[model samples]
Target: MLETGQVISAENGQAQVHFKRTSACERCGACGMLANGQDMIVTLENTIEARPGDQVVVQMQTQGMLQASAIAYVIPLLLLIAGAVLGKLALAPLFAGVESDVVAAISGIALCALGFLGIHLLEPRLRRQKRFQLQMVSVHRAAQGREEEQIDKE
Candidate 1:
């Protein structure tokens, strides 16, 4: 996805850009939707020589985005289903006296929680990888002017 953001700060080959959340951002939910209407600020490598106050278009890798979405959404769901099946089949047989349904519920919940914890633990390592990073495509001078004009009109 491509987004327009204003450079908030720049130094030593890096820049911090602030993006206001829009309706499109709601669909992605990359930044948590807390209902606070706050801006999403990200620090990116400054290959384009964008300065503070400059408006630029940022691009995130499409493949990486899809991979991330799968990792965040699909994997946990698959894990939950696997957990439920395991509880019903494997774990139920081991806990002889207990009700099979109850054992299944408990085991499934435990495994689902473990899946979430695993994702949390893996996040930091994912962030350090360059393949998943967002990039600044170009400074959008014309778009910036249009934005300022709209603000003035409002």
Candidate 2:
């Protein structure tokens, strides 16, 4: 849904936005993130003429940042824990009663390694998807009609 929001932070062609939800977003993966509240990243085609604390109207699709970040960590952790548990309960009996703790530890370590590898593989693509700064559209003031606003940000 489209709504007006403020720029909370901006740097290096990116801005962190804060806005309220206008419509109930089901977050049906159309936005590629979960829609829970009114916080989002707006990437601009050019350097935005907005500074922090400026109110701008943002039209964005809602998505799940929390879910993505959580899935990145939690699934691997669960796999690790389960592997450790299973190693102790099921496999320990086969290897002349190998120590469950040791087996679990090894499995957990392997799972953690795999998880980290996945993160490393995805890091570059994720970075590329980060928002770029948006340019200023026309600015309107009560005293003035619609005028183009431009800023010289070095």
Candidate 3:
């Protein structure tokens, strides 16, 4: 996804850009850090030396987003199915056809919960990887009063 935002602050070769919420972002809860439904601040390297009040274009890799979606949604589903099958197999002999299915269902739910917990704990590290981050690739306007778009070679 691509977005246009103004740099709110700049320091240490990085900038925090403030972006207004758009219809394209409505379904994407990826920016969960948004304080409200209307705005978001993203910190990224200021490759174009953009300053506060500068307009910039941010690019987020669509492939990485899809991979993240799979990790967040599909893995737990697979775990649930595996847990159900394993639980049923293990309890079948013990229960001998008595409430084993119920026990398996509970085990599947518990296993899926664990999967979610694991993903939550690893999120910070996953987010630190560059492939999953948004990159500011162009400057629409510099704080120095230029109105030209500056495109950088990626």
lDDT of 2 by residue, 1-154 (tens): 3445566676886655554534544342222232654444454433445667666554332344444545566878887887788777877777675677888788777877787788769766754553311234421222235554533333
Task: State how far residue 25 of model 1 sits from its true place (Å).
Answer: 2.8
What's the distance in Å from true for residue 154, model 2? 25
**Poorly placed runs, candidate 2 (over 4 Å):** 1-62, 130-154
- Steric clash pairs (candidate 3): none
Q: Which wins on lDDT, candidate 2 or candidate 3?
A: 3
Candidate 2, overall lDDT? 0.54
Q: How well is each residue in 14-121 modelled by candidate 3, as lDDT tens digits?
A: 899988989877666666447676988778888788888778898889998888888888999998988888779886567665687887897788899999999999
Task: Give the per-residue lDDT of model 1 (tens digit) for 1-154.
Answer: 8888899898999998888887766666555433466578788898887778878788888898888788788888888888888999999999999998888888878888888899899988987776677888877443443663212100
Error of 3 at 43 (Å): 1.7
TM-score of each: 0.80, 0.44, 0.79
As a whole number from 0 to 100, the lDDT of residue 105 in candidate 3 is 91
